[model samples]
Target: MTIFASYSIKGGVGKTALAVNLAYALREDGHRTLLIDLDPQCAAAYYFRIKPAAKFKFKEGPKLAGRLRRNIRESDYPGLDVLPSNMAYRNFDIMLDRLKKSRKQLRSILAPLAEEYDSVVLDCPPNLTLLSENIFRVADHLLVPVIPTPLSERTLEQLYQFFKEKKLPPNRIRPFFSMAQKSNRLHREFMAQLRLDYPVFLDTVIPHSVHIERMGQRRRPALDYAPGLAATQAYRKLCLEILKG
Candidate 1:
């Protein structure tokens, strides 16, 4: 199974939106997809109308995987399941730190689900913590949603630097412009400059749209509620790009 993580050091850059929609898109394409909400906020799970997972005692590898498996809830949409996050997930870093191979423990924890899912999309929490490192180590593709701005650019650079310093595979990072405002000169400029500098950026750009922002109220992917909209089309295109890669 291919593991795709929607992550960023900076939050509010459309990370959860990407994860939620990507998982939906994958299921639409006939893949058995599992959306794992690692964020304690549980926004992804909330969007699917799934409640927060019950708190469970942390354990190593197989035990932890079983606990997570038990928490998996079938989404309203078929072929898509969600493993909602618990408030206790905030201690993931601490729990991972207790492992001998903390950076790689996530791989083992998630390995058991490989047989059941064709794709696993992770809605990761924002920050560069030990848990984030574990995510970096495990995810086949790290889908980073970068807004077209100086701050977002800097954070992307920081992410690359962290990968370099830690000797992680930077190639796994697939960044794309998120909440892009084509009308803004600076946004357009930054998008062009970053694409030129980082050839790895995805060609599909998710536009800043009210449809996307209303996901909280709609509690579903834009593709489901507004499939004809530009943002929804962008997400579908983005999913196709990742699948092609």
Candidate 2:
């Protein structure tokens, strides 16, 4: 499976929203997709109206695959399945730390799932940890959401620096503007600067819209609940851009 992680060092940058909609968009494009909620907040699962994953011990290879397979919950949408997160995931750092080659352990655990899925979307938690490092090692692409602002820009720089220090390929990280407001001068300026600095910035930008916030209330992808909305259209464009890459 091609693994795509929606990640950021800072929270509330629309990471989960991107994961949810992008997974749906992938499914809409006819790819068999699985969205794994790695975030302790479990917002992606909640968005898909999926139940929480049962607490289980983390094991290796086939054993670990069995545990994950048992928890797979089919979504209301066709071609999309969800592996919900539970509070047990908060202990991931402790679990991974005990394993050898911890930074690459997550890739091994997810390897077997490739046979069953065409794409895997991860909704990751904020902050850096061994688990985060494993995610960085495993994900085929890192979709980072940047809210056009000074603090968000600084966080993006920190992420790039971390990648440089770790010797991770910078091209693997794709940053895009989220919750952007064209009316705001600061937002426009920061976005322009970001584009000039990072030519890899995605062409599609997600706007700040109440409709997106309603995904929580509606418990569905925006494309499903608020069809033809600008936010939904933007997400579709982003999904296509991701696929093309």
Q: TM-score for each prediction? A: 0.98, 0.96
Candidate 2 lDDT tens digits, 155-221: 9899899999999888899999999999999999999998998889999999999999899899999
How many steric overlaps does candidate 1 have?
Answer: 0
Of candidate 2, the 10-residue stretch with the lowest lDDT total is 57-66
TM-score top scorer: 1
Cα lDDT of model 1 by residue, 1-245, tens digit: 99999999998999999999999999999999999999999999999999999888866665787887799999999999999998888989888888898888888878888899999999999999999998999999999999999988899999999999999999999999999999999999999999998999999999999998999999998899999987788999999999899
Model 1 residue 240 distance off true place after TM-score fit, in angstroms: 0.4
Q: Model 2 off-target regions past 4 Å?
A: 58-62
- Name every residue pair that clashes in candidate 1: none
